[model samples]
Target chain A: MKKTTLFDIISPVMIGPSSSHTAGAVRLGLLAKHIYKNTPKKVKFTLYNSYAHTGKGHGTEKGLLAGVLGLDVDDRRIKDIFNSDIAKNIDYTFSYADNFKKHPNTVDMVFDDSMFVSGESVGAGEVAIRKINDFNVKLTGRYNNLILVYKDKPGMISQVTNLLQKEGINIAFLNCDRNAKGQEASMIIEIDGKMNTSIEDEILKIPDVYFVTYVEKLEN
Target chain B: MDTFEQLYKECLTKNKTIYQAAQENMAIEADISVDKVRSFALKSLFEMKEAIRSGLISKELSMSGMCGQDCYKVQQYYKKQNSMFGKLFEKIIEYALATSEENIRMGRIVACPTAGSCGIVPAALIAISEEYNCSEFEQINALITAGEIGRIISLKVALAGAVAGCQAECGVASAMAAAAVCQLRNGRVSQILNASALALKNVLGLTCDPVAGLVEVPCVKRNPFLAVHAITAAELALCDVESKIPLDEVVDAMGQTGALMSPMLKESSQAGLAVTKTGLKVQKQVFD
Candidate 1:
């Protein structure tokens, strides 16, 4: 029910056997790439349910790799990604699972043997980044956002938002998810507009905020 | 914010056309100028044309080899016999087939509402524009009108076959194409909305049953069929034939119909034609 754009309805020229399986797979890869903030030397994809069953016929695998390699959805090179030079440099493997608990079109992108970002192709080429590592977080790329992984503690939210208030940035939406009390937690704050590297640096300067990722808004 | 009635009232209050209101609405939403929205739209239009051009020539099968160059066959057939439906009809069918075939082959395509339903709007708009010599601005207006209709309906139902069956994809796409073509021919707001209503009402409970779970078979061929379907609705609306149910009510009905629809028929490919004997055989031939 958001103010849907003509682009949302009529655009995003893409390579397709499907929008959700192909384009949306590419977007999930892109989001995973953004979250890691670096290309992994090794990666593994765990596709679940429908994606696991029909991904190959749909070029879902190609789109997923092409996206992590920084290809846009429309790139014709997506169809030949297995033979593409970009995918050759990295170690990548795909495993399928049947998980009714997950959405029908869902995957977990495990980067560099450790970082795991789970997401779902909700529908219509739209996606949601649901969990990072083990924390339940929401990153939809609907806005310019920050994902702060820190030791969970009181006053961390206020500390982060107070810095934004000083920089004249407004928090449009925010969510906090933690592993346990006083342990590893993440604050996913979707902000109004562009935030420079200085904001990330400022957030990192906080005592318990060890990691920060500035996620750009999604193109599709 | 979701219904056609709101958009209609907004259009009337501002004395702006549906296209104008859509443009203004997009500009406001994205915090950009209307020119940028129009520019982006024109880019999509060009890409749609490019997809058709490529598809008319290529014979690339889908990854599963279930569908591929059916469009080329249609073009060849048209050249030989000339279509019984006449020039515009031939153009509509050929362009629709061309674009959807292009999509299944992994060629570039604009997802007008979605990739599975991409062919309808462009097939209608391009056929008319090429035949009638409509200007680029007029084409943009038609696309904007189509987009607005899609946007309003999407507010009620997510425009995905997985969410709401083919009614949300090809069915809504047919309605969007009707609105676009109606606008291109200078039908006013009322007629445009009615065209959309008629197209949607006719396709209620249309399922998403692509054999082999690919956007081929029914999807590619459905493009040409539904592109022509839009024409019927547009023609009736042009003659001042109003829909029994209004546009807003039609969209609401579509939403309710989608909810009432069995999940098996809504792109799960578990029931309907997807699980037919031939469908299972193709699924085996492709995936097994």
Candidate 2:
């Protein structure tokens, strides 16, 4: 279990109405932004279950858009993000759905129809990115993460861990997913220490490694 | 660190107050200085006060039009007549409503435990501090004491309405507020714990059924009600009244009760007041 701190219990001074719906939505968008690594020309957000039903009143849509545009959870501009100048550059639309299989407060961010990042607002303004396109991944935005997409091959995990070992960086959690044998695969590494572009550059140099992104932990 | 019993033992052994023990423990857990922890808490305190200041003057309705003018109405009422309970009571209710109304209006607030129950702890702690002329340092101590209470309870139960119910959100907030108020009143460590236990044990099984699934209906008004509820527990504890159940045991029971509760009543908007006749109408009005 993750350790609960006094800050986790009493802090995160944020724009409110509902923590799971509003603040968590913003976090999901922020994480999605980090995972995407850049802003897209267009994005479509699909809110599911409880988020679909009550998201508007709680400003979930605004939160998601504001976050995608790099707004923090506490930014007062989130309330009118639709009219904000920063939001003018990106075309955004929202669609609602009811999928019982999905978590009650789930959203899918389709960026430029090229990247699909699905995340859930898991109670108390905490979130977990569950899927990135076709690959299943787990990202809580708690620790700095190193994400990689590559062709499935033997020893893909060792090659990555070996690089971190050389750097004296500790791996806290590692999750790997593949479509099938010898097919596309993805790796999500949650590390205990800081990340530098040098590590990401080295990972991208590995054979069959197509993508690499270093996501810094969210600043609360 | 995981249970109130352990926290109590540590406090007794170290001969420290709840805030002292809590800040030290948090400093170690978070790997930061005690001063950093207090500074973060002070930041939230200032935000809470700012929310109250902004909310007290605004009468604008929330996006759903269900709430937002309530704090203004209360302010108006107090101007015409004082509350039967007196000045402290007026401050508590006004502050509670102001914070909550600000929330639905998409204003800033400190989610003490959560945004839904954001008003409870601040209203109780801030009101008492103002009424008693407590120092900023004393207020920080009380706030840390409240955070410690919530953190311990959260170890036993997740402090979210979706995970447990309102019992875990507003219920836990009230308990935290009771502990904060008790600490501000200079109650002993045992009495502080007793105050929280008294608050938690009474509000067990409280459902989280917001009308139209919005935090406006019961959530906005419930803050002031529960803020006062917290004071009752503090008053009782300060007078040497004790809960037969220990604080840890009460939290355990709360966890059990939440598990036994129907999912429909756990922030799903499927049963209870969320599905009432007017609830359905409000839902349609808001969504359709």
Candidate 3:
């Protein structure tokens, strides 16, 4: 069993109606925003199953938008956020559907024209980033995370991790998902501490590394 | 990651209490000073109190308008009634409703195990602490004790309606609150464990049937009901009452029962009260 912290039991002092719907929505949105790495000019949210069915009641849609706008999970302004000036800067639309295959409280985020990120509000204000664009990967945003979209080639993994080892940043977890043999692959590494800009530049310097993103740990 | 039994035995051998063992173990696991743990627990207590303080004055409903203002209604009823449960009883009900209502309106709250069951622990701890005049330090210890109880149960079952329904959420919270109240009265380790087991064992099969898939309706009302329920368990435990099954075994039973539950009865809202004619109508009215 995973160690359940007193913080996990008693904290996260969050804005609520539902933790999974509201707080988890904010978290997923924050992670997607981190992956996108910019203030989105336009966005579409595809809420699935229970999120579609009961999201409005729980203010999940509001929570998601507030999160994308860079609001914290405990921000009181999220309740009336749609009317806020910050919301006026973005173009956002919501659609609902039931995909029996997806988790009940799942959302697919479409950012700009090309960035598509899908995530799930698993429960109890815990979220997991399930996919980025068409690439399937796993990220929980619990730790400082490094994400890489690169060619599937030998030594690529070692080269990326070797940079971290040189920087003395301990790797907490690492995951790799590839689209095809010797083709495009996504690698997500959760590290214990920060990987500075120099480390990023070093990783990007590797051959066949298409893109790199560093996502900071979510704020408590 | 010692089991509760292992922790208890260690406490007895070391001549330390269960809460002390919990605090020491947490201090090690989190790599923080024990005082830091105490301070962190106090932070949660303050958050819980803030929720109650704000919740008491607000009359906001949920976004769906299916629930809310019931806390206000309870406050009004308490003001006029003179007979039954009296002030402390009135405080428990009113505070529970208040905190839960605040949660629905998206106010900041300490989710004791969860947002849906946030009200129960605060209701019990605050009421008893205030009436008995316990210090904030004592209150933190009680809350930490409660947190450890909740933590142990959650190890067996994920404390969410989607996973194990309200039994794991609200039921476990009631158990947590029971342990807290036991600590407030200076109950022994055995008594505290028994109180938690009694509270949990009674609500073993309780379903997480939030109507219209919202945490309001039964969830908000259930907070006060279970907040009061913790009292029965704690009172019995203080008298040296024992649960036939141990606390760990009771938690294990809860996990087993959750595994055996119908998918619809969980937070999916596909069955139970969520499927009632009124529930379906509420869903349509709010969503459609």
Of the candidates shown, which would achieve the greatest DockQ relative to the real structure? 2
> Residue A111, candidate 2: how far off, in angstroms?
1.1
Summarize candidate 2's per-residue lDDT along B49-104 as a digit string, tens digits.
99989989999898999899988888898999999999999999999999999999
Q: What is the lDDT, from 0 to 100, of the residue A86 in candidate 2? A: 92
| Candidate 3 ranges beyond 4 A from true positions | none
Candidate 2 residue spans exceeding 4 A from truth: none
TM-scores, all models, native as reference: 0.98, 0.98, 0.97
Better candidate by lDDT, 1 or 3: 3
1 against 3, candidate with superior DockQ: 3
- Please give the lDDT score at residue A67 for candidate 2: 88
Best by TM-score: 2
Superior by DockQ: candidate 2 or candidate 3: 2
lDDT by residue (tens digit), candidate 2, A1-220: 4778999988898998888899999999999999998978899999998899889989999999988998898999999999999998999999999999999899999999999999999988989999999999999999999999999988889999999999999999999999999999999999997977799999999999999999998988
Return the TM-score for chain B, candidate 1.
Answer: 0.98
- In model 1 chain B, the worst 10-residue window by lDDT is B1-10
Candidate chain B TM-scores, in order: 0.98, 0.99, 0.98
The global Cα lDDT (0 to 1) of model 2 is 0.93
On the 0 to 100 scale, the lDDT of residue B122 in model 2 is 94
Query: What DockQ do the predictions score, one after another?
Result: 0.81, 0.88, 0.82
Tens-place lDDT per residue, model 3, A1-220, is: 2367876898888899888999999999888998899879999999999899889888999999999999988888888999999999999999999999999889999999789999999888888999998788888878889999999988999998888988899998899999999999999999986778677778889988989989998976
The C-alpha lDDT values of all candidates are 0.89, 0.93, 0.90
